[model samples]
Target: MNTTRKLLVLASMTSLVTGCTSLPPDAGFDEVSVNVEQRIANKVHWYTGGEEDAQVRQSIHDRLAQPLTADSAVQIALLNNYNLQAAYADLGISQADLVQAGLLKNPVLEMTRLKPRNGEDASLDIELRFEFLDILLIPLRKKVATQQFAAAKQRVTATVLDHAALVRKAFYEAQTSQHMEDMFREVTSSTEAALEAARRLRKIGNITAGTFDRFQLSHDETRLSLAQSEMSNRASREKLNQLMGLWGEQTQWLIEGGLKPIPFKPIDVNDIEKRAIANSLDLAILKHDIEALAERSGIENVKSIIDDLEAGYAWDRESSGEWSDGPTIELRIPIFDFGHARRARVAAELKQLQDSYYARAIEIRSSARALSDRLQSSRAMVEHYIDNILPLNRRIKDNELLNYNAMQIDVFKLLRAHEKQVASRQLFVQALRDYWLARADLETLLSGRANTVSDMRGPAISMGGGNEGGH
Candidate 1:
């Protein structure tokens, strides 16, 4: 075949190869959305500023019209959060790289014209050059880019999952804070009434000044605590709003649920470490890195001596219309850079990735075990309050009421028991919050999405005598 015909044939083959990987309209978000939906029942959308943007906005608006639940809150964030939408850009960028890798460089065309001094004769030369070596390397290049793109998808998917977990955590925190504020408000009211009664007693010289002062101080402190609870609730609610990408009227939305008790049940976590390592996207990404590097190392080793190669066709035509055509070849001789450094770098990276993957596996296993323990401890703490501490406080309050009715105890003792009972309930609320947080973290980890360690030690509920804790 003539050089021109051969080049045309090669071009035809290249075009045929590039058609295999055309991306869908949403890039790769369908897979991510499906994965998230399967795992958590959360729906995700990539807002394209098209008709779907209005749909998602309407969806979020509808969900926000009522009181928010944790799952709905996460779904809204996945659809509406600007940050999550921004994160979807990585998929687009990576998919572009993958598509680019599967194609050959464009052919370079050059034209040259010459005229004699007599101006009677002219020479025309035309040449076309392309990186013919690229055709051979396209598969390897695509292989590497494919793995890297897969890694990018995994990482971005992990980001979405982690975001969902944070939304859940923030939702529970806001819920607990809301309930805490209400409880403190009630406590303050009780304290105020008791202080007023004590004031009447002091006026009648029935109680000492010290006793009246204590009652007055308790009421003042309780009011101050109510103020603190209000601010805390505000802050937690605002954080949840930020995660859900809400502003304006959406910020005024209410969380529906209180700190409902999570059932205390035995969860088999003995295999959780193995499952975590298996599911962890972090390790999966490293595996892709290792695969791409290994493939790259083999390619570089095979082509170490050939730094650059190009071949094409050249044609020359004299002014008499006589034409000549031939194949042209160009090669770059490797004198100083034999790709030794490049090969060594790839090799080193491959080794580093291997070792790092091993280390990360260990870390994931440890984190899984730690999170499992935290989940169990949180569950135990919640159950302890429900089964022991709160019940005991209620019983003590009952005994105090009986003693007061029988004239065996003073009002001060009865009030003290009542305060302790309220503190236990407040503490129980925080314990439930911690239990939910730990559950979110563990589930995210086991699903191979997130690797974060939550604040297993829950927020303290402070009252007069002691602060409540879940640890």
Candidate 2:
């Protein structure tokens, strides 16, 4: 081919590669949002320091204007949580990288001037060189970068859903703590009234000093329990506030409902595990990582043999005013560093990803099964407390009251029966809390990294009759 024809062909090829590698206007944000919405079914914002800031602020204000429900709390977090916003920012960074990968490196420009010793005319040389090999690798790099961007989207979506799940669990915990605190307050009030009655009886010689002492001790214990419950309520509220990204006045928001018994529903354990493996963001990211690494390995294999190549056109005018134009080429001789280390590193990385994929799959399956069992067991326990235990305790308290009215039981006995009934109700509350917490854990297991379950288990309440040895 003629020199002009070769130059024209090279120019056309470069233009073709550049044109094929351009990014879209939105840089894939819309698609990321769509994927997030599909998983969370909630609105997500990618703040760009634009007009959307006002919109997100307004949305947060509107959601927080009412008592915070679980869904509303999640929405607020998605709009306001700093961590989730940071994850969204990663999407922008990945897209920028994708764009950068598609872009061609600017050609190197050099100019030289020389003057001959024999009073000859000055001559100049100019050379423009491009990494033509990089042009050849443009499509491959772009493909790897595109996969990276895709993984970024998945990561952002997973983070949003994870935050949503966290908000849910925190909301449930705060509500449970608040309800338990209120229950303890009621128990304390009942104990105080009983203690006052016992004091009057003891002063009138109708009850023994020991009986009054028992009432006093129970009242003090109830007060202590109430204080602890109050502390727990405060801590749980603060945690929920933090998860919702609330501060100052926003932290004072109310929860709409307390923990309640979850209705029993059988879940298909196998289906859950299947979905977890298929939809897990960790697994997805790893899969993308493997793909990117495979592409990188391909590049590395090429580099292992021929490290570098550069080719372009150069023009020169000699001291005699003789002009020359021709193609130029440069190559890096691979004599010492042969890229074996790079190939081994990539091989190790690929193996690690493959193992991680399987490991994550196994973890998801185990967690799914465990969570399903826990949910079922917790639901059953809550129902047992609500249906069988609380009513029986109430009946025992009613019978003790009747016995007191008929002069068959002492005031101490009646008071102790009431306390037992209250204790049973507290147990019922704890069961409800456990059910809700387990439900939240199940969500976390499915959604990838949300709020974790508390390690503390509820105190086991025996189902026997009321205390009969009261003084």
Candidate 3:
């Protein structure tokens, strides 16, 4: 065959091979979304620039217009958070790599002119070269790329779920801060009333100067606590706003309710470790990494045997109009470096990935167990505060008020009782916050991400006792 016909045939074969192995248009996004939906009960959208549907943004805006619930907060974050959107873009990058792997490298064209010393016309020689070895290795390369893309999809999905969990935690935290701020304001009002009564009684010589000073100190302390709680409230609200991808007017959104109550029945923790192992996305990604490495090791073994091979067609035309055409071959002699180092490196990577997979599995199980225990403990504490401690403190406050009304105790004593009651209620709010935060952590574990439990500590509740001795 002529050199031109031979090159054309080679190009045809290359096209056929690439066409057979090309990935689907969606590139596994639908599959990844299905898995994420099963775990989070929320679907994810990949925004391709202007291609994002208007309805999605509209839905988010409508949800924001209403008082935000925890589930709605998660939905808005999944749909609109810029960080999660960036994570989705990473999937596109991996898809591009996968597509590039399946494609054949472009043919190289070279031309040379030779002029004789006799001053005759110059002869032109032309060559077209194709890296046929890459064609031979395309299948293996595509397999590795496919696995890597799958791992990328899992990583992106895990990130989305992680963000959703964060939004939930922030939502509850913001709600808790709002409730605390309101509680502290009430306490402040009560302190002001007690201080006013003490001043009046002292002005008329009915109460000691020491007692009036105690009431003034308590009022000052209550005001300081109220200010701190207000700051905390604002900070928590801003954090939630950021998580929800809100700014400007969006920050004015309201929460539907305070921190949710603990469930009546404790969650079943049986075989949680086993379940976590089965569902862990991080472990799945590591397994894919190992698979890709194994495929790479195979390719390296092929290269170790024969390093480089190129085949093409060459043509030459002389001054007299004579033409020549023939096949050309280029090979690299493996004298010193025969891909041995590459093979060894791939082997080391495979081992590392395998070990990492096993280590991650162990970590997931351990984390599942620890988080399960914490969830149970947190639930018990929340229930204890709600069912016993808070009601008892309220009863104590009621009895103190009755005693004071009957002139059995001074105003300072009654105010102290109220302050203790508020302190107990504040503790109860903190326990509720802890319960919700633990629940968020548990969800993250169950969704196959290795997120550590957030710190459950909150602002301290002053007992208002330092100045009580002045009475």
Model 3 spans > 4 angstroms off: 1-7, 20-27, 49-52, 453-471
With candidate 1 superimposed using the best TM-score fit, by how many Å does residue 251's alpha carbon deviate from the native? 2.2
Candidate ranking (TM-score, best to worst): 3, 1, 2
Name the TM-score of candidate 1.
0.88
| lDDT per residue (tens digit) for residues 1-471 in model 3 | 266777688768756765744446666678778988999899777676554658788888899899999999999888888898777777777887777776666677899999877988889898988776777777777787788888888888778777888899888888899999988998999899999998889899998989788889989998999999999989998898888889888778888876777877777788989888888888877777777778867778877877678888888989766888888999888899988787777777677767777877888888988888888888888888878998898898899899999999987788888889988988888988888888788778888777653211111111111111100
Error of 2 at 118 (Å): 5.5
Residues 197-258, candidate 2: write the lDDT tens digits.
Answer: 88888889998888789889989999999999999999998888788788988876777866
Query: Model 3: which ten-residue window has the lowest total lDDT?
Result: 462-471
**Which 10-residue window of candidate 1 scores lowest in summed lDDT?**
461-470
Model 2 residue runs over 4 Å out of place are 1-16, 20-25, 49-56, 116-119, 206-211, 267-270, 447-471
List the candidates' TM-scores in order.
0.88, 0.87, 0.91
Model 1: CA > 4 A from native: 1-22, 49-55, 117-120, 207-211, 318-322, 453-471
Tell me how candidate 3 scores on lDDT. 0.79
Question: What does candidate 1's lDDT look like per residue over 249-332, in tens digits?
Answer: 889887896876686466668789888887777887788777777777766865677767888778898887688888899998
lDDT of each: 0.79, 0.75, 0.79
